[model samples]
Target: MKTLLVFEYRRGKLTEANLELFSFAAALGAQTAGVLIGAETLLPAYPGKLYLGDIVKCKDYNPEVHADIIMQAAQKEDPDYIVFIHSSYGWDLAPRVAARLKAAQVSEITGVSEGKFETGCCNGKMRRLVRPATTKAVLTIQEGAFCFTGEAEGTPAVEKLEPSADGAGLEFAGYEEPEKREVDLAKAEVIVSAGRGIGKKENVPAIAELAKSLKGELGASRPVVDAGWVDHNRQVGATGQIVSPKLYVACGISGAIQHLTGMRNSEFIVAVNKDKEAPISEVADVMVIADVMPFVAALTEKLKQ
Candidate 1:
């Protein structure tokens, strides 16, 4: 099999999802090529033909333009499989690539073997197998779903590409930098989440200190995020980010269904609330009922030992 990976860069490097997709591609034992579109001072070593470019450096993004850039490379490379990471860019670009090539698209594919692909449904509660009818396939992969294949043997041969995207339907607008993240919550092993039960923003240190003692990342519920107690990036719930940490500590969370859907898959759940009847109790492996502040403070003090 021959594969083409369209990579999106983050901070002058391949995004984590792109790296993971590359790992998946390498494991398929297929001949692989890459088309990277961005300006990056440094690139990780890859073991394939790499068409690196900076065409979008000064233009507003138009999916048609990106699709054309990809297609120009595709015409030269003629890959049997074109792969993308299911990111904001991927959502826009994949369909265009698929339509132009008149190929079947297997989206959010989590696993692939023997020409069969696996995907998740119902917010990852159920799995389904997909087999494309076409000889060639265009795939978009979900983040964190695939195991990374080990690094390739040597650096890839790099070539420059100069495909231009004509601004057809969109124009460049002003850009705003996103909020800086305090932590990478998705990679955290343990997470301590605060909900409305935490009482006030000033009392957050009591819970945060406890999370610190446990060597866990501090997460916030929607209310906590809305109340300006934490950055929106640290918010965890249906409206926020979904997390699946090794240990999930729910501090004063009422366990709304929206929040539950985001974290129900966590390996171990420990719920703490003054009200034992809270919905969170249903999913908790261990439940603690008490005034949240005193307990958090005492636990924080104990963990100092």
Candidate 2:
């Protein structure tokens, strides 16, 4: 099967997620290739074939124009599967490309078998596998679901495709930086995430103390953030900042699929919850079933000794 992996050049080079997509495509079958749409193009390190197109005039994210460019490349390659990383750009462009090609599209894919996909269902309380109704498919893979192993051998051929984009009456405006975050949790090595089960906002400092004792950043579930127990920037879950820390300590989190989807990629997970059946336990490396605040308090006290 031929797979087309579309990549976005971020900052100075292709993103790690882009390479992860290539790795995923490699396993999907043979004839793996990559496509990039930007102001300029470069040969990717992927061993499978590479396609690059220099998007002229437009410099920012215009889904209409970028999707058209990818569609042009796809027509030449005629790939059986077109894959994109689940990012702001990919989430927007993948559907457009799928519509243009009249192909099936799946988003937030965690696992893919011969003809089926695995994704979270019922707010992540269950796993649902789906099989595509068509052979031609477009998919957006969840970031960090598939670990990237650099196994591409031998230099692959690079093909420069014709870049075509009208931008659909969209104009590039000056970019404005997002407000500087108080704590950039994405880079933290260890994160202690608090959930609503911590009882009340007054108990938050105990969790904070545990985080301090562990020398980690303090994060929160959406509920905790909504309850004002922590800043919104410190929230860790879907619709919040995604973190891939070396250690993730989830305190009282029920492991809602939205939350699990965000931090399940952490190197090691330790969940402390009274409910043994919590969904987070499925992905945790260590499960400590107990009252949330007392455990944090005890851990903090013991660490002080």
Model 1: per-residue lDDT, tens digit, 76-164? 89988899987677867898999989998988887887888887665445679989888778888876666576763567677877656
> Tens digit of lDDT per residue, candidate 2, span 1-305?
88888987754556767767866776676577778865343545656666666655335566676787788778888988899888777888899999988888888788878777777666556777877787688988877777787654566576766647677677756556556678989999999999988989998888888898989999999988988889988989866888999999999899876688689889999999998878898899999999988888888899899
Model 1 residue 295 CA deviation (Å) reads 15
RMSD of each: 6.6, 3.4
What TM-score would every model get versus the actual structure?
Answer: 0.67, 0.81
List the candidate 1 regions with Cα displacement exceeding 4 Å.
55-60, 180-190, 194-218, 221-233, 237-247, 250-305
TM-score for predicted model 1 compared with the true structure: 0.67
